[model samples]
Target: MLQIDRWKRILIIGLCVIGLAYAMPNLFYKRVEAHNDAVAAVEKAGGAATPEQEAAIALWPNWLPSSLVNLGLDLRGGAHLLAEVQVEQVYKARMDALWPELRRVLADQRSTIGAIRRVDAPDGQLRIEIENADQMSVAVQAARGLAVPVATLTGAGQDDLDVSAQGNTLTVQLSEAEKALTDDRTILQSLEIVRRRVDEVGTREPTIMRQGADRILIQVPGIGSAAELKALIGTTAQLTFNPVISTGSSADATPGIGEIILPSQEQPGLYYTLEATPVVTGEELTNAVPSTDQNGAPSVDFRFNPTGARKFGEYTSANVGQPFAIVLDNEVISAPVIRQAITTGSGQISGSMDYESANQLAVLLRAGALPAELTFLEERTIGPELGQDSIDAGRIAAAVGFVAVIFLMVASYGLFGVFASIALAVNMGLIFGILSAIGATLTLPGIAGIVLTIGMAVDANVLVFERIREELRTAKGPARAIDKGYQNAMSAIVDANITTLIIAAILFVLGSGPVKGFAVTLSIGIVTSVFTALWVTRLMTVTWFERRRPRTIEV
Candidate 1:
């Protein structure tokens, strides 16, 4: 009567084999990691590997599962950075773009509004004074016409700009709702750009997320230091091509309103005045790669999207023989004269850069520019030695807990406890196997979760063993007692584990960072523990009883 079906026994054995197989790589972490890295390098190098790389690859078989549970920042040591994004910079850029449209709308009534002049205002505000005082209403109305509905959920039906007029001066600024939306968008974009930049460098399991209103938290494991991480992402790399107005050696030379002065990269102290509006910006770039120019000099070759190509073609065709400045982060890299129209949509950027610089520039361009500047507020570098110590501590704690649980289970339940202990081991293997398959990161808190699971894993076995003892006291044979014991304990086991699993899910949904890691491990442990207790231990017990055909059993 107490027996596992042929298919069910096969399924249980199959799962145990698969789980242990997947978990095998963690036993040889360094060798497996090196093999993985070498494989990646070989693929990156187009299936060509050096002698050392080939040796590393040969260390592990390609047919076996090589996935390992990624180590979290706390367990691997790395760079941590807290940066505040300068979101207001985007507001100034928005206002600058709005100026031309607002000016044109007001100019339609130039006869009434008279002379219009832009006045200096705060960074995020646009203020203009008109000569005709009585016609201020017309200017205000025209400026308000440029206001559009905010596109965010909370700011629905709200206008993006708040326009007000005092005397002959009309002032315009972003609405409060729009500002909030913009801040959210700015942080999201900044997060994405930072992720792309970090991913380009091939770091493992970097934690890049929004911290607050305008802050980002970045934790990259295996990086050298915080300064090195900062260096990789700090550059704004804002590239724009603007029509050059004039060239001058004086830094203080004023270039009228709507034009900017930037120093040349090659010629020290030499500056070029360029139009404020660019013909094409880096945002329109579709692709960029390092290449050699006509003179065999290092350069970055770039291709533009259709819209950018059209704008570039028209600008070059109309301004033939005119110089256009290639500006990067407000500094002019070069001001080359356009000898002919460039309708091909591709161009090269050449300056005082070598191949390394060109390659770095190409990477940055391909990743796109940061939406705004970032000011680092806090930075810390964690050493790998500390991470290794934490890892060792976790391992010891888990092993101690595991051994203590095994000892108690065996002493209390006798032979039944041995079955439970074996199931517990299988439960751990399943936990790690699932983690490796899903590529979850293991943190210190995750280790804590696993240790806690080791203690909890025996609960079902205890219940089943106690029930078997009760059945044996009622004079039931070993087979009936075993079957009834498992059946009677099923409800309690499911009830307890289900409630804990719900809590784990809630923790995962509401928490972040280490809390999330703990929740993930705990959740996986619960599922695997339940399976091993209900199916694995029961199968082993049934097989033993069937083979022995014992008339009575000691608990």
Candidate 2:
């Protein structure tokens, strides 16, 4: 009996030593530079972060935010938004792509229909009119090539059309029927546009994802104010370059219909003539860098690729000294006079702006273009106070649970129960060490996992004690009873824990965000509990028995 108890004691002590050693890495991990920098920065910002806190930050999960593990919005207070991308513009683009085909189809049957005039519907549909109902029927056959199957078909026949209009007011019913609402091309194009627009306001780590149908969900933490985001996203960035016309010229002439004129070859006038055709478009520039001009003034230096450079060089050579306007999203950012031919494919854009404005303009130009305009449907922000309150409540609950479990074990198993309590404490230390090693954030639910582990830690001891009682009643000697108890209890311990572990795994796989956090902590706690209970507690009990052999075991 003493021999078997000695062996169990040795085994438990060895595991404890190894566990402590395995956890040693977390001690040094507390000193990583990123952890130090974050702590120092927080202190410099007038935040009261103690050394103990700085150490805790290092142990947080790598996947979680660097800040403290906060409760979800349900536990803590936060804002929520349901943002959706406007897909009407997608329909508009589709209509534009089909416009050319429509024009060709109408022109091909112009003679048969006897002159046809088409009006564009606001919802991006075409309404065709001819001489009479007979002519309309003929034109409809020609337009069939350009017409797509209407998902939401309405109205009766040609006289009572699906799309109706009176005088100039037109109404077309839009629906999501059997028709394909959006295609892969339109979705990709929309995503790119949203990305560009969101980046324009210099948002930090915005999570933009495509949702069901035609919706996008954007999540930005630590960003409370969303008015600026709304402004940047809602506005359509439509850019156009029009030539500067002479004041003396016809005021009745349209913007782009003016005569193509250039500045004089060798004269500097207050108002030099300009060309109706743009010399170069902004799309040609591959990159824009914020730099200082030769005069030390803030300027944006833009560079073009091989194809764009050749076209830019040709345009500059043809229009030397001509004033060209630099337009951005329809607003003229600058109008630099072509003083000299820029054949090098590189040019500087100098606007009457300060350094901040120049930098922003350069950033926008570099970010590329958006295919469609984005509309902000929702915005949310959470205060740090709410997160702190959650932490406090969770701490209280965990502390109470810890004390209750410790007292329960000690009362239930007497001396062996006391050792179980110690093992329980060590088990918790190992869990934190493991959590710290793996960089897992400890949320409120994670605290619950730890508390539950404290209670579960005594499960093996209960099984061992009940087996020992059964063995003694069956006429086994002290040593034999102890060995048989441990052997018999192992299966039950494994079975119960394995079932719980499986449940935790399922919760982790199926849950999201906070639920997943709870599952992770629960899973880790289960493994830690089994180790401390089956091995650590058993070893301590065996060691005590070897030293002080009791006569008839007292339950």
Candidate 3:
């Protein structure tokens, strides 16, 4: 028993020492670069740099660790937004895909389904009007298998011969299977696109996650306002080359007019014609950077591929002094009059763009564009003020708690309490070391988890002492009682700690951000505390007894 106790103490202390060494980086210098940057930015802003600013500036070392794994939005001052993806758009895409098939089906079985007419509704809604009541019923029945779980059949009015409505207003409802297919594809595509775009923007610790049904949650730390986020995700980013149509007032308005028509890829009924030929297409874009023109006005300078350059030169050379429209996603962004041919592969986009707008456009162009529009559904940001307060409060609370726990243990158990306190200190060190090693963010809730572990850390000691007391009452020798105490209490200790660990695991899986942090610390604490209390303290006690060979074991 004495030997076991001695070994346990040695292991616990050694591990704690190793942990402290590993985590020493965190204790001394955590956010050197960020602090220095903050100070520099403040100085640049013409604000008076105070002593605290100077101290922060002095504290930051270039070689030190960065400000990663810091507190979250609740601790920091930031904006939170909830944006939802437009699911109806996914449905529309599916319908557009089925357009050719539907047309084919209708032509084959003309008697089965009635004449089909496409109708455009408000807010991008499309409807397929089914003509003739009896024929419509036949068509609806025929389309049942295509779009499963069709809604209740709507009857045509007595006077009205046209089929008023069916499920989805297309004489067929989209099946659960169809919706699932469309939803999955849309979400998967949107997520990937959003991630790529955000990553390009270079926001620190950006979080773009999918939510319920058709929603995406985006969280960008240190980016307080989401005006930038909105600009990035809200755009469908559909880039196309379109010719400018002449207003017929002047020859310059012709913009190298052309008459080529391109059919819409997504929609059969939709077709676009270029009144003037595009000098260059977005596909040729290589890079775009925000820069100031000769007049010091903000603009986006873009470079194109060799093919685009050749085409641009040809188009401009043929039609000098004509206005060429720079179209983006079907909207004319700029209509610059061509003074000369741009033979080089580079072009400048000058519009009514302010400095910020120009910079944002440059960022977007650089990041590439999303294939589809993504609506944000949920967001949460940690505020810097809240984070600082949490850190201060957590530090104080932990300090006071540790001191109280130490006093209580020593006061209650005398010599045994001293042993427990040593083990407790080691437990704290191990937890911190592990957290630092894993680069775990210490949240406010996580601090609470650590405090909770403090109380529970003494549990094993309580059990051992009680068992020793019982053994003493039974007239067992000092060494014999100590051995029996550990032997008897081992089963109870394992069962109780294991149950707590299980609960912690469940909490981690089910809970959200902060909750998960709390669960993590709590779970880790339970394991470390058990190890320290059961082994470290026991070993120390055994070593002391074996060395001193005291005849009397003080209760």
All candidates: CA RMSD (Å): 1.6, 9.6, 9.7
| Per-model TM-score on C-alpha atoms | 0.96, 0.59, 0.66
lDDT of 1 by residue, 1-555 (tens): 788899999999999999989999999999999999999999988999999999999999999999999998888999999999999999998887788888889889899999999888898899999999898988888888889999988899899999998998899999999999989888998899899989988899898988778899999999999998998888888999999988998999867777788999999989998888788999999999999999999999999999999999999999999998889988899889999999999999999999998998988898889989999999999999999999999999999999999999999989999999999999999999999989899999999999999999999889989988888877457788888888899999999999999999999988888899999999999999989999999999988887888877888
Clashing pairs in 2: 1-479, 60-439, 61-439, 61-440, 61-441
* Distance from true location, Cα of 440 in model 1, Å: 0.7
lDDT of 3 by residue, 216-240 (tens): 7666655656675676666765444
- Please tell me which model should have the higher lDDT, number 1 or number 2: 1
Weakest 10 consecutive residues of candidate 2 by summed lDDT = 152-161
Winning model by lDDT: 1
Between candidates 1 and 3, the one scoring higher on TM-score is: 1
Worst 10 residues of 1 by lDDT: 471-480
lDDT of 2 by residue, 315-384 (tens): 6677677656555554455566677767788877775667986776666566554545555576766565
